[model samples]
Target: MTIREHNGVGKVTWKAEPDAHDYPAAASYLSLIAPGAQAGDLVGQLQTASLEHYKAKDMLRASGLPLLPPDNPHVAADLAKVKNNKALSPVLLIRGDLTLGIALQIADGYHRVCASYHLDENTDIPCRIADHPGSRVSALAAAVGGDLVNDSR
Candidate 1:
């Protein structure tokens, strides 16, 4: 694999996708893209929770990221979409020492989770959790389309 540098950081090109369950381990290496971020071992664990809208709001607020009212057109639209179809993927979350003390910063599917929570205070949210210190977006972004190894297949 060719090693390339971006902004003075070297990374080995991934030739294939790692197992879906290995996200946490991969995230630790990927955190190099952003300083003060860390990803812990995968728990191989998941759970369903009925999170409240206010709680979701609080969760997002604690993330230290700009808060978008659940009623925002896009948020509302996504909420409606989720209400109509509850078959979407789980909400992805990340947590780590440097991350805000918020319960878990949303790594992916924030809008969808918000919508789910807004639609029903007791909405059943399936979340794939991880321990990571990267900014919410960066953590998930790397997994989806950044320099970190991914399931490109």
Candidate 2:
């Protein structure tokens, strides 16, 4: 199925042809975020993010991350591991473009990102970015045949 957000209307479709079914609440949410976009276009691609060094503080600032570290115990443990240079893996991220401009959303490794930033403003964290619309509620709703309004809190 395909959906297009042109102007303000969400054109829900299947194989480029408009389907008769009404869009669920999740589709409505997607429509608002990805205006002037096709449903297929909204979920696009995944790639290994460029190995560029970014200032930790700047990255957190751009992402609107809190100054305090994560409260989760696992995150704290991971942070400690990372600080000790025991974390051999990099963080997973989804490249995001919101009202705050471009930022990297932590799909995984929030602790690592926070730890690296808090430890040193100059620290650079590695990331694997998924450059796509990053919204799958609509598709999930369609699959489950559930209304997002009722299913989602």
Candidate 3:
């Protein structure tokens, strides 16, 4: 989907795939929360995962993460990218395990997500998601013909 206005600027464009640098960024962030090896593993999964789309509001809700203010440096930079017609990279996510009370992890592109939210809460954000290795949610979902990554929300 195309977005016509963001912060009173030009249209929002999304990259067909995540930038090459995004994997390392995601691995760096994931390392803090998961084992280094597992972080690498998750990044690998994200690399091969199919692209998916979700509304900005739904991502924030599922992540249980507070939206970054538009004035935040990173967020502002992303807004500027939109203003300049630079395509933003697709977000990388680690699926949440509700049973274990783990909220979805925004492994990378939090600022971009916030920027998209600033544009429109209902804006569809492109994302690539991976299941947490230890989470049984994906397993159960697969068993029951449900999907853990591409949530309809």
What TM-score, over all chains together, does every model reach?
0.42, 0.46, 0.86
- Tell me the RMSD of model 3 versus the true structure: 2.9
Q: Residue 145 deviation, candidate 2, in Å?
A: 34
- Local accuracy of candidate 2 as per-residue lDDT tens digits, 1-153: 222222322221213211122123223433564563542233232121333334557667756777555556755675555444453244444445564365655544455556555455555554434443433643454677734342211
lDDT of 1 by residue, 89-143 (tens): 4455554434444445565556655664454433444445444433564466567
Question: On residues 1-153, what C-alpha lDDT tens digit does candidate 3 reach at each position?
Answer: 344454554578998889999999999999999999899988998999989888899899999999999999999999898878888999999988888888899999999999999988877888999988768966676688754555554
Instruction: Look at candidate 3 and tell me the lDDT of residue 108.
Output: 98
Q: Which 10 consecutive residues of model 2 have the lowest summed lDDT? A: 11-20
* C-alpha lDDT of residue 100 in model 2: 34
Distance from true position, residue 147, model 3, in Å?
Answer: 9.7
Cα lDDT, model 3, residue 93:
97
Error of 2 at 101 (Å): 5.7
User: lDDT per model, in order?
Assistant: 0.44, 0.44, 0.87
